[model samples]
Target: MLASLLDSMADSLVCSVELEKTKGITVRVYNESGKLTQTVILDGKSITIKSQGEQKSSTIIQKEDSIISEVKGSEQTSTITQKEDSVVIKCKSFQVDAETVSVKSSKDSTHESGGKLTVTSQKDMSLTSSAKAALKSTQAMDLETNANLTAKATQNVSLSGLNAELKGTTKASVASDTAVEVTGVKVDVKGKAQLTLEGAITSVGENITTVKGQLVKVEGALVKLG
Candidate 1:
């Protein structure tokens, strides 16, 4: 008895679909060229728009501003649509071959890719914002080139925060007639120390002691000479 009831319900569902097809709304348009010639409505959720020639039919979820959106089939193609305050765009593959391209988001925008992303410019590329802009990654940050990297400011340029570190194979140059100050609770130097200048130019204000492992070699005074 249960099997018979299930079979009857399946038949009813098939009949309802056939009735919907037969009783679908068809609107024929007169003097319509390069537009939808007929619009078929089976229910509120789906609609079909028919064109003239080889671009015959397309089933869309919504239609607005001469665009059919959320087309039903394998690989869909569509344009823009608006639902309330938000606007959306859908397509298979889009291409624009023009002289220039520009995209701006009023608020914040986000982009994610499972593959790779590449950006190339012929000349210079500058990024500026009124607020802060930050970029961070989980693994590592790499800077590779034989070129020079410079940071300059009108007032101050400082490498500060916890313990500052510098790792370079070449030499580090400092400006002439400028000050180089190193202050800490205990300054430790692991390698050999070398100091070279024109005359007696550096002032320590305290004492500078030179030690070799366990023995102290010399203790000297620093004279401030301008």
Candidate 2:
């Protein structure tokens, strides 16, 4: 019935409505050139709509379990799929504005940004990895904490740089279980008030040792000079 109706209006502007017992109902529109420009199908299980333009096209399909919408142009294509459990969107660029948003993946997920990526949380933010995690920056990276910052490792922690300095406003301490050694071409240990060196055995200056003070006194159980 629909084929005969379409054949009757082949060269004219045609708008047809077909209702079939087995296939379902269909509505179609054709241009004067007999080119199909629009189509709509409504069945027991699904509904589909399609529109065609000179340089762009759009299609929408709605089913019992899913709905898909797609648009195509010369430069870009966009598609959206909505299912019972999930929703997926594909396009050239995407942006979202919401009070809260959450994303989860069962297996693995990856996100790539060509330009800059920034994440901001007003309250708190946390990231956890089951195995290992690494952070790298090509140019430079900066980390600042307003409150307190803590880092812990089970095995060992190492810090290396071309030049490194450690400072404390109130006090500073270096403690180890076995031994502590400071090696440099020249080392300076100074105290504003008093300086004390205590150990089981104290040894200073391999090549030469110098003691300078206004009043110098050497006190030991037995003082020996060579």
lDDT, model 2, position 131? 96
RMSD of each: 12.4, 8.1
lDDT at 42 for candidate 2? Answer: 92
Query: Alpha carbon lDDT of residue 116, candidate 1?
Result: 70
Report the number of the highest-lDDT candidate.
2
- Candidate 2 per-residue C-alpha lDDT over 93-198 given as tens digits, one digit per residue, 9 for 90 to 100: 8888998888888988999888888888888789999899999887877878988777889898998888988887898889989978898877889999999998
Q: Which stretches of candidate 1 lie over 4 Å from their true place?
A: 1-57, 61-68, 75-80, 83-85, 90-96, 112-116, 158-170, 176-178, 184-208, 211-226
TM-score list, all predictions: 0.51, 0.65
